[model samples]
Target: MSAALDTHGKAHDGHDDHGDHGHHTPTGFMRWVTTTNHKDIGTMYLWFSFAMFLFGGAMAMIIRAELFQPGMQIVTPEFFNSMTTYHGLVMVFGAIMPAFVGFANWQIPMMIGAPDMAFPRMNNWSFWLLPPAAILLVASFLVPGGGAGVGWTMYAPLTTQMGPGMDLTIFAVHILGMSSIMGSINIITTILNLRAPGMTLMKMPLFVWTWLITAYLLVASMPVLAGAVTMTLTDRHFGTSFFNAAGGGDPVLYQHIFWFFGHPEVYIIAIPAFGVVSQVIPAFSRKPLFGYASMVYATSSIAILSFMVWAHHMYVVGMPVAGQLYFMYATMLIAVPTGVKVFNWVATMWKGSLTFETPMLFALGFLFLFTLGGFTGLVLAMTVVDVQLQDTYYVVAHFHYVMVAGALFSAFAGVYFWFPKWTGKMYDETLGKWHFWLSIIFFNVTFFVQHFLGLAGMPRRIPDYALQFTEFNQISSIGAFGFGLSQVFFLYIIIKAIRSGEKAPQLPWDGADTLEWTHLPTPAPYHTFENPPTVK
Candidate 1:
């Protein structure tokens, strides 16, 4: 964004009127292919993320399709296992993670009043890493034994026992890890150094603050995941027995290390959702975000608590009672800060002039359903409770709520909230409401029943089921199908909005106080602030 204007009052782009950017005349698809503009890159990242969501959602559709009946009537058990593994990896890495990066790329520059990300060339390189990594991941299915069937967790002994597909999966992880590390470092440096003159740490927008935290978390935890995979690779090829009990290595240790990374890795996928909600609720509620300082504290609190609770995920695998109790309480402590966040959202809208536009509908959906997910999480956090609930469909149900209903829903909320700004066109309001209601309703239907299926003693990772789960599974499958179908409408809404929808004005929502709304345009151009625009 522009520094304070000169006495003559022209926006400074760090260039003369006749400079390169001044006359650059933005045009070309090749510009997108080679451009390093933050807006362009951010848009690319968002679309790619959505594409991966569909790609992986297709797998979820398959899994639900197969489970529609009592037996493995569709794919083989091995292939079913591959679907789970590939779907998890692809969604976590390829979808949710990239979408957050997309948000950061799109917003962080403007939020801090900078014209572009700190290291533009490096931004290009980080994005380029994605395709090769995606190719390797997709290639694993064509390998002899099919893809990695060990599930996305890829716990050691099973992973080590796997075949060629494991090798490809490992390579894919390696490349993806490198990409993430590069992206994290770039984000940190950009946020640290790229802000405009007036913005300070506390003055910076909530989105920037959350991203700074997320970048640090990525740097700290992702390498641990890479190491865990490395050991798995070595055990498979070099004869190391890190996970082989017979060879004097403990498989459980791998779980400890993997989850050391895995658990926080989940938050790595989520903290941005926290940031997105923080942005949307205030914009639509026509109020300042309630407890802004408290929101920042709660985010940090959740990050710190995230590290401690990684062990909670390991509780069912068995730990000493003392350790288990400590983890149980520590895990429960997370609920406090999270509760603060949810309350802040509700309070932001408590007595305000709220409108149930598409964005608010999504934000509201997140508030109710994500809390339900959080409640289920707290239930599983108890030491005794987890023992009974662990590894069953209950755990699966809980996470899907948190991730799918919580994180992914928030993502859609963000997209709808920001679509006008990004597209310069208004979405079909009636159609958007339809997408939101059906998606939220069907999502709960799909996942809520799975909890009982787990409590009813259905184990996960099974291709076949006994008769007791028949009815709930049938309902869950139908819900999943409906949820999947809902997105087709979402895509239609977006396309129709872009092609022939109503128009959106700058400062689309009066309460959108962020610099992004004031300083940028609907369908913001290929480049913004090639010279700074004053934030005023």
Candidate 2:
């Protein structure tokens, strides 16, 4: 294998320019179905995730509409529960996870100078599994009892009592977990084995580092989730007593098992977001990341600690005081690594040539809001506090801050940072800023008040609220509507960029040090790094 010219128009890979590698590339719809190209597959993953985001967002709109005036204005209580259940499911599984995977599909190979994923066909299969799972999930809403009314947590006793919709949710969970495990396997294999010759373990970019860690977390945790759901399925039909207290089973045991997987799942959503912010902040600030090695260690530390803290979520279940103290302390330990990451990001930007481009703006939003979420999480980590706030809107507010601010905001930053590279066209900057500011303002308006509602004794996952909770719910609903609509501007910006926009420069940003910018073509070629580029 000979090397080729990198996007720098330099001989980073000493191969002949075998121009236009698309001869083997297929065309049209069948091409998408049958293709194994990482770029094509990544594009599919992104579109699918976005469609799910929209579908889930629509469900959110219904939930908010019902709560807008607290009188069952839009949906029945049962259907409201269904909306809440599937909304959480669709957003977490269908939206956030796939979005990160889509990024992995697109960037990981380019970042590591690998030709493609280690198992490209498995990569394709991993993505293809999601649609059926999503279909079953959505179709459950039309079934006899509507969708599962239990929350996305699907606590056992409630889960066992639901109708066929519960069964659909269980099956959907199994399929989704299978997809996650396969995707994790592919990522781990590629990151481990397929780096270009000179890219050592420590030499890879932060995004690669984060995914490598995230893949491990996925492999470790997804199966536990699968086991939990499988037990649910058995209890539903196979006469198993895994969670039925009437049959010598313990519902608290279900909570234990579920949170074991659930706590780690939080970082599974978050670590990749950390990776994105790590890349973007340094890029716009024109500084090397302040503590690259420390960043890696902190991330790993967080992943390690995630497994130890699951029971913090179950403090209300009357666990032994020793167990509660241990989990609470362990959960609090997660803050050390997370805070290190935040500090490093701040230090990287300190006294540097910081520019608030769309990506930077979003990254800043992520840092600020995510820190606030972290603080709330600390409060919730206390056994006594969590006992009070466990099922309230406070928990809802806490996670949305983390999930939306941490994951979704960073995802937006990533799209803006890389969109030019992906599409060969620049998005409208003014519109981009508009989207960011509106989203940030309205997002705070939405969830910020939920903290008050939770403290004021407003419960979550409920369709109607008492008169005392009325004004806050109304404010939150309005904000939700605004936040939801701002994403339309985002979609428009993306479509406009793809269809007709200014051509992007090969190096669109000023300070990026990664191979994707340093080596790849302006619009990255269909087949890249055919001959791996040796890292310095």
Candidate 3:
């Protein structure tokens, strides 16, 4: 018999045939509310992330609108600042991060030939914790004195002066941190302890390997963020002075602590993205991943180097020249490993049978735009150039290129790549391509000009600018609106696929060789790998 079938001719290797398991599966709303099934929780995480993405996108609209024609046409400067702050917070914690965790939840067990996450109930808890935290974060906007206007970094002193909203933000951070730590623990345990009998450590898929590294980054860094916020909270209410200059604390101390956590948090978002690209590029190229072992080493190197370069963000905040030099060199060092991964991706597609599927298109977009972002990052890595551009729109452009192009684009690619398996329905290919073209074009239209504006000395986080900077701002605002509309179209495409698209075959992509594609059925099963398939 084939590995996917039994002598009786019923599919037996945990195929999508779930008739026998129906009774055991929970139905109705409570299935999502109380269930520990990794797939269900993964679904929840994805939807939640999308919802937050829209919410954050709306805030971006407000920010863009206010800056559409210069002098604060729509919102008060204070509210504009709040929009920028919450927009960053929601997108980072609520949208991008959760989306990847969703991917991890769905793919890890299937990829490793395991039945469920290591801590199923805790998995349930980890997801549930997020809604309350999101509520706290969003609700802060309505609290007395409005939302915390201190950037997402929640810098001290300013944070200490904010009202009840700051408390809500702090508490929300605490809850979110708890959730991340729990999720990391679960991921680490599952990947480390639950692989199939013959799948050695180095034998795992690139996605699994990337996530393993990200989980450790989360475990190491989340507590630091929690501690930073807790100290801010105490300084606010208890007269403690961890960041209060009057109490012998230096505010710059807060920058040091926050960046230590912050820099790793950047990779906590980007590394999984690198993993997604790793999987998509290889599959679409119809080739095995180039330099698989080197990719793994490069990922680890990036993580290790992430810790050494936190002070780069602090160079302009008044570091000694020696400190600046060390950080400058350290920041530039990240490019080496990042370059290796980029080289391997291109080499994977070299002379290969390449096709421009939606996933592949987005992966290629990520490769080009993310590398552009990295180059700009190198420009800023120099202490002298950074001193000139810190807090300018140049810095803003670099960040979005890395973030939107790097993380968000890869996320879109992963969604499209796995959508067939997840929903057992193929999306409208035409619409998928439309979404890609519109997003990539408008994304560049929005951010590319910001580089020039920053070079001309347009500072970020401000509502208005001088007339000299007006044209590029107008161009950026228009592009922002167009980019926002493209994402809405993306939503429509996803819903249409799930409800009325063509049914997908069991193996949708010929080049995909993971266990989920090779051994499981389309849409996957309520239970998979009940009996693990040993890897060669």
Which candidate number maximizes lDDT? 3
TM-score of 2: 0.96
In model 1, which regions exceed 4 Å deviation?
A: 1-18, 21-29, 531-536
Ranking by lDDT: 3, 2, 1
Per-residue error for 471 in candidate 1, Å, reads: 0.8
> In each prediction, how many residue pairs overlap at the backbone (N, C-alpha, C within less than 3 A)?
4, 6, 0
Ranking by TM-score: 3, 2, 1
> Per-residue lDDT tens digits of candidate 3, residues 285-348?
9999999999999999999999889999878788889999999998999999999999999999
Worst 10 residues of 1 by lDDT: 1-10
Per-residue alpha-carbon lDDT of candidate 1 for residues 202-307, written as tens digits (9 for 90 to 100): 8777878889999989999999999999999898899998888999999999999999898888788778888888888898889989999998999888888788
- The lDDT for every candidate, in the order shown, is 0.83, 0.90, 0.91
The per-residue C-alpha lDDT of model 2 at residue 264 equals 93
Q: After superposition, how far is residue 248 of candidate 2 from its true place, in Å?
A: 0.5
TM-score of each: 0.94, 0.96, 0.96
Between candidates 1 and 2, the TM-score winner:
2
